[model samples]
Target chain A: MKSILTEQQLEITIKRLAHQVLENHVDLTNTVLIGLQPRGVFLSDQLVDEIKKETSTEKIQYGKLDITFYRDDIRKELHIANRTDIPFSIEGKNVVLIDDVLYTGRTIRAALDALLDFGRPEKVELCVLIDRRFSRQLPIHPDYTGKSIDAIVSQKVKVFWKNRDGKDEVCLVND
Target chain B: MSLSTRHLLGIKDLTVDDISLILETAEQFKEVLQRPVKKVPSLRDVTIVNLFYENSTRTRFSFELAEKRLSADTINFAVSGSSAAKGETLLDTVRNILSMKVDMVVMRHSASGAPHFLAQHIPAAIINAGDGVNEHPTQGLLDAFSMRKKLGKLEGLKVAIIGDIMHSRVAMSNIYLLNKMGAKVTVCGPPTLIPKYIRESFGVEVNYNLKETLEWCDVANVLRIQLERQNQVLFSSLREYNIAYGVKRKLLDNLNKEIVVMHPGPINRGVELDSDVADSKQSIILQQVENGVAVRMAVLYLLSGRNPGNN
Candidate 1:
């Protein structure tokens, strides 16, 4: 396993992404944050916390979306459902869809499908902690990328959260 | 992954993994119910026919709605209006339906094992909606799903199923399913309502006393006494049943533990359970209704195979 981002590197990358988001949306008035289920949700929680610490933004609309049903590979295998506590509506909101890593862009595509079921958002942007280059099956691209990596076809990128995994790091391992 | 059988005939036929698979798939679709646009284009090319020989409007409608949400074209067979009313056999009616290229048949018949018979004869997938005191597999699944959701796990959880044990498909299916999921089950009611072989055949304990049964269980799925199904005197009177078997506040408090109250509804409120207990915090009766759609969707989604048109 090749370590990509250490604890300090992860912190710096997250802070940079948070600053970039704040710079783009000053008030975040119509902007709501949604994270893909399970793994992506950790990044969302950290991002929201970092954003709140840096800025005086209160009442930030944050939700966790489960894209299990919308996934293309659902029929191919079994997928356990995750928590989907998106209470507020994303209708007419500038939605920021967050995930830990962008690999084949299939998960983002599924998230997009799941999001459209909620409501027609004004605009939807993708944000990721790591973006794998030239490995996308779809034309989707992340608007806010933290650390872009060029991993081989047979390699897998695994993101480990500090709270859940007892460390904050990213690894690229050969399959 | 596909189920071992093409048709879901009964809970007796499902393994614990099969039960878990259906519940997990149902949970995935539960999010769809919360969405504003409650339609998914998953089964656009497939067609399902709801063939009900008996009047189960509630269960039938739930399956129909689930099919619609999955974008599957549905043909709600009016069994009474069709040639089946003119004394057509179940086999002939379904054969005619299958000739129309129907991909799946969700059947609710008055006779036991009607879906099983159709399943053997027909090529299309068969889901036993309700088969005359035999099994309502989806209802059993939804109840177990709700149980797992509330109690966190199914294994080693004690569940007490009370009232109308003799004629309830719900009771039989729940007993088979909860047992398969490694939960202890007790069927309690009048001596006449409790079948003798249920204890010996299934190994689920039989209880005649309500208070003792409530004390023993972590969950009590109080079932509606089907008056329509009752042709003989099973009990002395409704008041006696209420007094002896009905789940109310006093009996619930005797348990002194968090016991979930559940019902397969169209409830005989005062007969099987009181209003206070039915509407209480311990009850997950309403959540069962919401889960019915999701469970049915999962059953449909998994059994129908991947939609070739989805890609």
Candidate 2:
């Protein structure tokens, strides 16, 4: 039932994950991070900013992806998310796929399919802001996880960013 | 960070947020045009292929300016000069462009679903400039963007699109997009010119009487009366059609002054609309042309995700 991660804790976790990412991925030059649209995009930017501040390296290329079309949820309708604005070519770049939370993993699968259409990335590592230990449909896990919360399928965790919301926090909502 | 794509093909494919992003981006681009430099580094290395099978000047030029201002490399490919007239298939020409390592392709073809067709196969982002009288998605976006700028809010706004309903792809795309964004849409044209089951398909009202439709909305989008489709559709004569549907001085007098007048050009000055009305203060025909570039820029930036020259 406790899916919420405090603001201070989330910050510390992201910092730690950023450090770990820098440590494992030595060459920051070829590394680029792509955030899944909405929340992941903002999180990817944050991670890039934090990492840049820590390492004092050139800014990592950030890409946003809208995986709505790749989603298996809604039936094929005329109106669906079709335009994915990824300006930079992903070819040969070491990509760090960032998302707000790792839930059923269907989104990650969709993201992967969407990414491939752009071009073949040299390597792609999953980075989740929060990894909720639940029923995952696919074999996907975060290479870099900000925090982990164990919760039932019915429970939900919402990520609040500082830009939109004055504070950054994850709350447990009863769905 | 940098955008990854360069073109937008259709509105059906664009999300509500994406639509908003393009609108917002267009607003930003519009500000730059007012300045002296009137250029940006967003598309320096990006090559935008304007592969138009159909003949268009305003739309084509709008896209060209949008790309050049963004610092993108713009290639104007027409059927006359391009290999397509030399018996090349649509897919082959697109493949050739792809092979050339071009970043994006903005296509205006006579085939209704050409953009959709290219969107499926091409690696470069496909932008629907206008496709086979099926969907002029960019025009719809520009029109909606213009309306939103003028009206401030789109929700619950009554908008009636009149003239050449069946042949006007502008009307078709606008109906879908405008209705989706919370505007009530009514399509009006001569009964013969209006396609069968248009109302039932899109959950919108259909009216043949232009006077009634004009009275029902805050904005009346007048489509061009095609000279070619006149006799074929058997709409009697231009003079008769003008008397009924034209936004003439008399009709304009009857409507509210605040009720905006619009047309997707090149207009048939006195056929679907009077010259005075077309050139009036309320007409957004020129603004629509200007907004076309910004909308196209936004589309190009969003689709390819590549920054042209600068961020």
Candidate 3:
């Protein structure tokens, strides 16, 4: 029902996440970034840009990944497919799986299955802009977290990117 | 919409949303097909039997590829002039096969409603590959999926299905599915090949003249003449049928509008379509073949409650 993150806060959180990624993994050769499909694509693109600017690294290796078919809730209803454009090989590379809002951790779990079809990675990690508190159905946790939201079960966490929705902000909606 | 149908007996049994869901799922699976390692470990424990009563090289091969891609252990049950012709009933044969603990049956029988009949008696999933003159649901699904991919949408698109309607499970299924998708489907062919009371029953228009049908439609689905199924009652000769219904490049170009040409293949190239037209830019015949693999995968995947081991 209210805006938890304004434009300035979203921009600041993105810069902080970029610094954290660089501080953790300095040598970015084998490190590959994959954005979960749909909204995560926008956030991942911004984060990739921030990392590149902060570290002076060209071609940080990022792509979109869709896990629609691998989802456990596939039979519950239909999910529209998003474009996946991972041109580089992820085999033996450090894979960074990124998403906007991490609610149940199920989407990331499905992404893990989808990533294996490409090839086996040396290591796989998760990154999310909004970590919805106390809402994970799986034991999966993000390696890099941007802004954690203390939201209840009935409310939803939504992230809007300036490139996409003409503003950068996060809001909690009553379902 | 979620898929809940126990059997894919026909397009007549599928709702429009069901058709949409299948196409959407096929879209994702199509991407999977393009991957280097195309096989997935989704249907690992599931045993699917490709029980083909009739011989169709493309359909059988496509279904086999789909089954393998999903990691389902598939057994090809091809009945020749042996047991099926030696007076063994279809029900008995299917039951005997099911006794082997098969999880699903993809059957292509010569008799209409054979799969439907099997679905009634069997506990396994029944996928009607093609049941004589009744339906080839997967073929129909892929055709619509291809059309929507090429044309951007299906609703209100004028689709003319030319040649051999009465004998084609493809034509019947296409009519049922396309009409449900809000596409205006006109059955065009020699009057003898078209079943009577289709207009009265299915409420679809019938066109006898090929040129008129070509000019009035956005896409023309040219069906191969089922020469094996025809007799003296239908038409005089193949040459006469070719002259009347065969789609040539000249006829398509003269329409002055881009009309997509589609054929459920094993194409009698010079009979239903000219060899040039079959390989023409406007023809999506190859796309139909490629899409058939994905559509069948979507069907098998959804039928088993999303078979690829859900994470």
Please name the candidate that would achieve the greatest lDDT relative to the true structure: 1
Per-residue lDDT of candidate 1, residues B1-311 (tens digit) = 55777789999998778888899878778877878988876677679999888887569889999999988999988776899879988898888888888888999988998998888898888899989999999999999999988989999999999999999999989999988989999999998888888888998999888889998899999999988888999899999899999999888876678799999898898999999999999999999988999999999988874434322
Q: Give the Cα-based TM-score of candidate 1 against the true structure.
A: 0.85
Q: State the lDDT of candidate 3 residue by residue for B1-311, as single tens digits.
A: 46758678899999888898889889878888887678666677678889888998999999999999988899987787458778899889888887887888999988998888888887888899999888999999999999999999999999999999989999989999998999999999999888899999997999899999999999999999998887666887778778888999889888889999999998997888999999989999999999999999989887863433321
The lDDT for every candidate, in the order shown, is 0.88, 0.78, 0.87
Chain A alone, TM-score per model: 0.97, 0.88, 0.95
> lDDT tens string, model 2, A135-165?
6888988898877778788788888888898
**Clashes per candidate (backbone, < 3 Å):** 0, 35, 1
DockQ of candidate 1 is 0.36
* Preferred candidate (lDDT higher): 1 or 2: 1
Instruction: Compute the DockQ of candidate 3.
Output: 0.31
- Arrange candidates, best DockQ first: 1, 3, 2
Relative to the real complex, the DockQ score for model 2 comes to 0.02
Better model by TM-score, 2 or 3? 3
